[model samples]
Target chain A: MTHKSLITSLIVSGWLALVLVGGCSIKTRALLFDGVDKEPPPPTTRVRRDLLAEIETLKRDLADAQKALETAKAKQQVKTADAPLPTELAKSWVELSELLPKHRSGQVDWGAALQAGTIRPQAGLDPTVLAYAEFNLDITLDRTKSPTMAARGLSAVKFSHAAHSQWLICDNCHTKGFQINNNGTDNILKHDYCDNCHGTVAFAMANLDTCDRCHLRLP
Target chain B: MPAFSPLLFALLFITTVANAAPEVMGNITYQRQGEQVADGTPAAIFPHWVHRVRYKCYVCHFEIYQMQAGSDKASMQDIIAGKSCGVCHNGKIAWNIKFDTCSRCHRAEE
Candidate 1:
């Protein structure tokens, strides 16, 4: 073969070898050291990790607050007699009223309980209707901030889940009772959305006595 | 005139040395849970390099840890009882836990 042809052949083989070896080395480097200098994975964020424990504490607090509020409310009729509420009962009543709001705002108020008459099972109402009546849930309205939104509450409500969950499943109201449009249509405080069922079957969703039943912020 | 073989040999030796040099292990940080819930404190930050330098991989890999993130629930109580981290961190082998050196493993400052 000519010297020129021989030199060209050597150059071609060298380039081929370099390309193959370089490509292999690049793959090996990536696979071996993909996370070498990268920061370690962050700790897992726990959601409701102590849910059972919280539930247990809530039960105890609710019982205590119920007892206190009942004692105070019992004296409501005897205005002329003037039976002062027990100090502990009065304190617990105040604490209970503020309880759901504080919990909705993300400050875990395990010691707070619901007012005594607030969660009573109505005797005259049907079992199914009673289920919807007792369904109480604390919902925080701060949607944009996310994980930290609970800490900041622009507006919030204590929804009666005990009243709803027993009679209706998630699908019953998730999309039907309210629009599934998650973009921004989730404010339960709106009169129209709540009035859909409140006035139709349940209590009317007016700014009167029915309003404070769900809206704990009302004076 | 000198042959080009010696120069070629020298270049090959340098290249071989460069390729064969021992790989330096990177520092690894593992965040442990349960520490926060137990005491309302921050999670523990474990520096893997400190332990790996002295012990082999098999020493703790499958036996003590399952090689999965958040799999091992090593509580302070378990460590005190000579399990998981206590295997070595016990008073006999490494730092003794009886000395209240929780900050050694836990982010007590945070």
Candidate 2:
């Protein structure tokens, strides 16, 4: 080959080699770690590690909460097992029995009974109705052995005269005694009876404002 | 080939937003405490949300009912005649306490 041609070829080859090397370097650098150092991806990696640590912490917290819940449940079970049974209703039953006329001998003049304080009128209750309740007490006390007989006597009475009082006083009378009406029923007392009488005749009983009259407040 | 894709980025953003958890309603039921005054009867059904709206937490939690759930002693007679929750739940204020309405407060056994 001629010297001129060889020189031209060498210069062109050198220029081409420089361009290719520059292009390759730019591509390789861009592909390798162009934005890596700029953004400090190590911080992202650290964040991922922190997230994993947080997840582990959350799992630990969840486990601790579960254990605490189980402990609380166990303590509650123990407390319930050690607790005493409630006997409020039983005591009330005894008090009611003591108030029955069967415990007293001789005829009870309901009108005089109220005057003598043998049967006190419940607060917000009608005095006349309370007197009628005395009559019911006399019959029930006389026929304690035969609930059927007592019920029959009660049913036979012209309850219309003191129907309001009967309903107010013995809301649970049938519920507590009669198997047909109150058998296996808890709180056999009917609220409708109380509402009906209280709503019509006695204003105190109407709004449930006189609950404290019969029941003592709990401390 | 193009190195960036706008559509891919938009899809990824949409997926992340859709996966967020939803808020739940606050309606909850609580059990009653103490002995069963009446056997075969379920515990009272306390509507948490309904009560929460009427009064503050302190009313029931501190003033009336204890903070601990199922720790108060309530009787059916007391409630029907107006006591405890029945003080407000009486027929005039809220629902009537009739034989048919027993199931409203006394839910069936689970």
Candidate 3:
């Protein structure tokens, strides 16, 4: 072969060799990327499985919490339904006075028996009449007797009848006094009772401020 | 970006205007003076609305509470269970009385 032709053939051969090396390097890089891509599948699948497990656990916890809440609410409802009547008045009466007067020996006449009678007329009679009648009978019957005797007689009256003991006790004790004296105010009555009975036999009446149930005026 | 969504901005503005303390409501300051068995160092600022709902004026004004504003000598412990605030605030119906919730009912000053 000629020298020039031989030189051109060598340069062409060198170029061809460089191109082949570059192609091999690119193919190696592509193979490396393919291997790396295969590695992520196991970890990604595990993460997805873990997330599903967590979701199931959360759902179970929520169901348990809801069931516990329902049980507690049902128990509370049953307890409230079975509770007794809130007879604070009856409780107060028993604590303040329970025994009746066998004999009379004081300023008030507790020996006198309460006579059945209709209540007198007064302002706001519908609310106050029943209370008034009860007080009048209690006061008159025990006019010349001790406080103990009066309390006993007043307490002996049955509370079943609205115009009887319930009416009387609410009026004479819880409501305003029958007299116009300043001491007859509901506030005064509660104070006097508390001073006498607190920490003694009856529960302290110091906090009873709801007197409108018996007294017509706002006082 | 928009400063705030239209709905969010409107809600924030309404809440700011409506939550202001009432102007006409009267203030209440209660001095201890050793009337209560528990801590008696500082007085309380009782909100009138707290009592108005459960009881009538007669309950406190002429009966349990004296007509005179400063005449009452109630203490913190005086109304824990069913005495003062306890009459209605007993744990069953209202807030439970405890040291954690002290500021809700008793304020040292105003």
Candidate 4:
């Protein structure tokens, strides 16, 4: 072949070599992206597995608690509706409120009204009456003990503690009308004390004719 | 004829109860003013049945008094200060000493 023709052929061969190298680079890039074509793998955190289990457990516990609460409420409603089996009156094992009569609104609980204090039960000698003296205590104010009562010839004043303590609490008369230490009927003469309830409540006031109510001796 | 035993039992029960005093639990009397026997001041008579009729053992026992009698020797001063019998005898709870005096608790032992 001629020298110039040979040179031209060499140049052509170089261009072909360049085209082949470019094709190889393109093929390598295709191979590098072969594994990445498909969809991404699922998330790693076991969000669905652990959280769903915990939520389910919590929900069941909550439902059980609600059911228990509802059952207790139903039982309480039935208990309130039904009367309990009879027991002894003075039995301490039972709640006294359960046996008490329906009291007035805003009034004190009579069952609780009974304090855990001392009781002068049946202070009087009359066997005919027991329920009356269950809370009753009869007190006598000796005229010899006081000069004012002695001068008036009133041997003693008969105070019916049973009549007062049954319906009224200690606070009703103590400190309000009488002091805690003042045990006599000395406060009875005061219009603010005895008359506050006696004349106002119901019982007729003891006039001059009822002088025996204060001084007469009982057999 | 079938109810004969029950009828007899009830009759006997009522008769027995009726013959006895309503409620009397041999009251205890305490008369000790530090070793020497107390004088003229009557020994205080503790009516056990009177308290037991309305209250349980816990009402007075271990609270105001001890289970063993004379274990708790009470003083008038302590009582007036709201201890022992004074818990209820404060003129409000039950009978006040101002009205009761010595005869209420301090009675001649029978």
Per lDDT, the best of the predicted structures is 4
TM-score for each predicted model, relative to the true structure: 0.23, 0.23, 0.25, 0.27
lDDT of 4 by residue, B5-109 (tens): 899999997887466423222356666576445455666766643453344333454446543344677787888898888887787856787744867777553
Which stretches of model 2 miss by more than 4 angstroms? Answer: A1-219, B1-39
Judging by lDDT, tell me the better candidate of 3 and 4.
4
Regions of candidate 4 where Cα sits further than 4 Å from its true position = A1-219, B1-26, B34-39
Worst 10 residues of 4 chain A by lDDT: A118-127
Better of 1 and 2 by lDDT: 1
* Every candidate's lDDT: 0.48, 0.44, 0.43, 0.54
Q: Highest TM-score: which candidate?
A: 4
Model 4, C-alpha of A11: deviation from truth (Å):
99
lDDT string for model 4 (A8-98, tens) is 9999999997786556654564565565345444555566667889999999999999999999999999885443333223332123334
| lDDT (10s digit) by residue, model 3, range A42-98 | 788899999999999999999999999999999999897545323212222222122
Sort by lDDT, top down from the best: 4, 1, 2, 3
Top candidate, metric DockQ:
4
Among all windows of 10 consecutive residues in model 4 chain B, the one with the lowest summed lDDT is B17-26
lDDT for model 2 comes to 0.44
The regions of model 3 sitting more than 4 angstroms off are A1-219, B1-25, B32-42, B108-110
